[model samples]
Target: MRHIERQIVQLKEKILRVGTLVEEAISKSITALINRDSALAQRVMASDEEIDRMEVEVEEECLKILALYQPVAADLRLVVAALKINNDLERIGDLAKNIAKRVAQLAGEGPIDLPAEIRTMATLAQEMVRQSLDAVVNGDTALARQVREEDDAVDDARQRVRRMVLQGIKVEPERVECLLRVNSVSKHIERIADMATNIAEDVIYMVEGDIVRHRSSDY
Candidate 1:
C-alpha cells in the first residue's frame, strides 16, 4: 500500500480503538448502575480521561493527514468521517460517564429496581453504538442506515421509562428523588443513542456520499 493508504488504514484502526473503548464504557456503566457497583462506576469515570486523550490524538492525526496528503475521493470521505465519528465517540464516552455519575449517586439507594423500559433503552442504545462502529469497519451503508433507524426504538424505550418513572413518583412521593435519578439515567441513555445515530449518519455519509437530512433531530 501507498503511504497515504497506510495512514488511512492506521486511522481507521485508531478510530475503532476509540469506538471499542466507548462501547465497553457504555456497557460497564449500565452494569454498574444496575448492580450498584460503585467501584466499577469509578473505573468508567477514570477511563473518560483516557477517552478524551484519544479523541484529541485522533483529531490531530486527521488534521495531519489533510495537511500532508490532501486525500481525495474515498480517502477524503474517510478522513472527514473520522473527524466527525471521533467527536461523536468522545461524546458517547461522556454520556457513559454521566450514567456512571448517576449510578454512583444511586448506589446507596438500596436495591434499586430500574423499570424494564429503562433497561431496554440502555440495551438498545448500547447496540446502536456497537453497530454504528461495525458499519464503519465494514463500510456498510445499509448497516449504518439500520443503526440510524434503530434510534427510534431507543427513544420509544425512553418515553416508556419516563412515564413509568413519572407515574411511580406520583404514587410514592417520598421516593420522588430516587425515581428522578432513574429518569436522569434514562435521559442520558437516550442522548447516547443520539450520539450513536450521529456516528451512523457519518458512516452513511462516508460510504454513500449522501448527506442525511436534519442530521441532529430525532424523528
Candidate 2:
C-alpha cells in the first residue's frame, strides 16, 4: 500500500474506535438512568472528555489526508464523510453525557416511576447509533436507509414520552420537577437518534454519492 493508503486505513480504524466508545457511552448512560446508578452516570460524564479528544483526532486525521493526498473520487468522498460523521458522533456523545447528567439529578429525587416510553426511546436511539456505525463500516446504503426509517420510530417514542410526562405532572403535581427531568432525557435521546440519522445519511453519501439529507421519505 502507498503512504496515503496507509493513512486512510489508519483513519478508518480511528473512526471505528471512536464509534465504539460512543456506542458504549450511550448504552451506559441509559443503564445509569434506568438503574439510577449515580456512579455510572458520573463515569459517563467523565468519559465525555475522551470522546471529545478522539473526535478532534479524527478531524485532524481527515484534514491531514486532504492536505497531503488531495484525494479525489471515492477517496475524497470518504474523507468528507468521515469528517461529517466524526462531528455527529461527538454530538451524540454530548447527548449521552447530557442524559447522564439528568440521571445523576434524578437519582437523588427519591423513588419515581420512570416512563416505559423513555425506555423505548432509549432502545430505538441506541439501535440507530449502532446501525449507523455499522452502515458506515460496511458501506451499506441499505442499512443506512433502514436507520433513517428507524428514526421515525424514535420520534414517535419521544412524542409518547411527552404525553406521558404531561399526564404524570398532572397526576403527581409534587413530582413536577422529576417529570420535567425525564422529559429532558427524552428530548436528548430524540436528538441522539437524529445524530445517528445524520451519520447514516453521510454513509449513503460516502457510498453512493447521493445527498439524501432532508429526504428521508424518499430514501
Candidate 3:
C-alpha cells in the first residue's frame, strides 16, 4: 500500500478510537445522571480532560495529513470529515460533562425525580451519537440521512421536557430551581444530538461530496 494510503487508514482508526471514547462518555454520563451516582459523574468529569487531549491529537494528525500528503478527492474529504467530527465529539464530551455537573448539583439536593422526557432524550441522543459515528465508519449516507431524520425525535423529546417542566414549576414553585436544572440538562442533551447530526451531515459530505449543513428540506 502507498504511504499516504496507510496514513489515511491509520488516521481513520485514530478518529474511530476517539469516537468510541466519546460515546462511552455520553453513555456513562447518562447512566450517572439517571442513577444519581456521584462517583460515576465524577469519573466522567475526570476523564473529560483525556477526551479533550485525544481531540487535540486527532486534529493535529489531520493537519499533518493535509500538510504532508496534500491528499485530494476522497482522501481529502475523509480527513476533513474527521477533523469536523473530532470537534463535534469533543463538544459532545463537554455536553456530557455539563450533564455530569448537573448530576453533581442534584446529588446535594436530596431526592428529586428526573423527568421521563429527560431520560428518553438521553437515550435518543446517545443513540444519535452512536449511529452518527457508525455512519461515518461504514461510509453509509443512507444511515447518515437516517441519523439526520432522528434529530427531529431528539428535538421533540427536548420540547416535551420543556412543556413538562413549565407545568411542574407552576404547580410546585418551591422546586423551580430544580425544575430549571432539569430544563438545562434537557437542553444539553439536545445540543449533543444536534452535534451528532452535524457529524452525520459531515459524513454525507464526505461520502457524497454534497454540502448539506444549512440546506432545507427540498435540498
Candidate 4:
C-alpha cells in the first residue's frame, strides 16, 4: 500500500480505539449509577484522561497526514472526517466523565429509583456509539443512517425521564436534589447519543461523499 493509504488506515484505527474507550466509559458510568458504585464511577472518571490523550494523538496524526501527504478528493475527505469524528468522540468522553461525577454525587443517596425510561435512553446511546464506530470501521453508510434514526428514540426517552423526575419531585420534595441529579444524567446521556449521531453523519460523508449534517431527518 501507498504511504498515504497506510496513514489513512492508521487514522481509522486510532478513531476506532478512541470510540472503544468512549463506549466503555459510557457503559461503566451507567453501571456505576445503577449500582451506586462510587468506586466504579471514580474508575470511569480516571479513564477520561486516557481518552483525552488518545484524542490529541489522533488529531496530531491527522494533521501530520494532511501536511505530509496533501491528499486530494476522497483522501482529503477521509482525513477531515477523521478529525471531526475525533472531536465528537472526545466530547462523548467528557460527557461520560460528567455522568461519572454525577454518579459519585448521588452515591449514598438512599437508593434512589432510576426511571425505566432513563435506562432505555442510556442503552440506546450506548448502541449508537457502537453502531457508529462499526460504520466507520466497515464503511457502512446504512449502519450509520440506522444510528442516526436511533437518536430520536433516545431523545424521546430523555423526555420521558424528565417527566418522571418532575413528577417524583412533586411527590417527594426532599428528593428534589436527587431527582435533579438524575435529570442531569439523562441529559448527559442524550447529549452523548447526539454526538454519536454526528459521528455517524461524518462517516456517511466520508464513505458516500454526501453531506448529511443538519439533515438528520433526511436519512
TM-score of 3: 0.97
Q: TM-score of every model?
A: 0.96, 0.97, 0.97, 0.98
Question: Compared to the true structure, candidate 2 yields what TM-score?
Answer: 0.97
Report the C-alpha lDDT of model 3 over 25-134, residue by residue, as the tens digit: 88888899889999999999988999999999999999999999899999999999999999999999999999999988988777788888888888888898889888
Off by over 4 Å in 1: 215-219
Q: How high is the CA lDDT of each candidate model?
A: 0.90, 0.92, 0.90, 0.92
lDDT of 3: 0.90
Residue 148 lDDT (model 4)? 88
Candidate 4 wrongly placed segments (more than 4 Å) = none
In model 2, pairs of residues that clash are: none
Candidate 1 CA-lDDT value: 0.90
Which ten-residue region of model 3 has the weakest summed lDDT? 210-219
| lDDT tens digits by residue: candidate 1, 1-219 | 999989988999999999999999999999998888899999999999999999999999999999999999889998999999999999999999999998878876766678878778888998988899999989988888888789888888888888889889889898887999999999999999999888888888898887895865342
Candidate 1 vs. truth: CA RMSD? 1.9
Q: Which should have the higher TM-score, number 1 or number 3?
A: 3
Writing each residue's lDDT as its tens digit, candidate 4 over 90-204 gives 9999999999999878986778888887778989999999999999989899999999899889988898888889899899999999999999999999999999999999989
Error of 4 at 77 (Å): 0.5
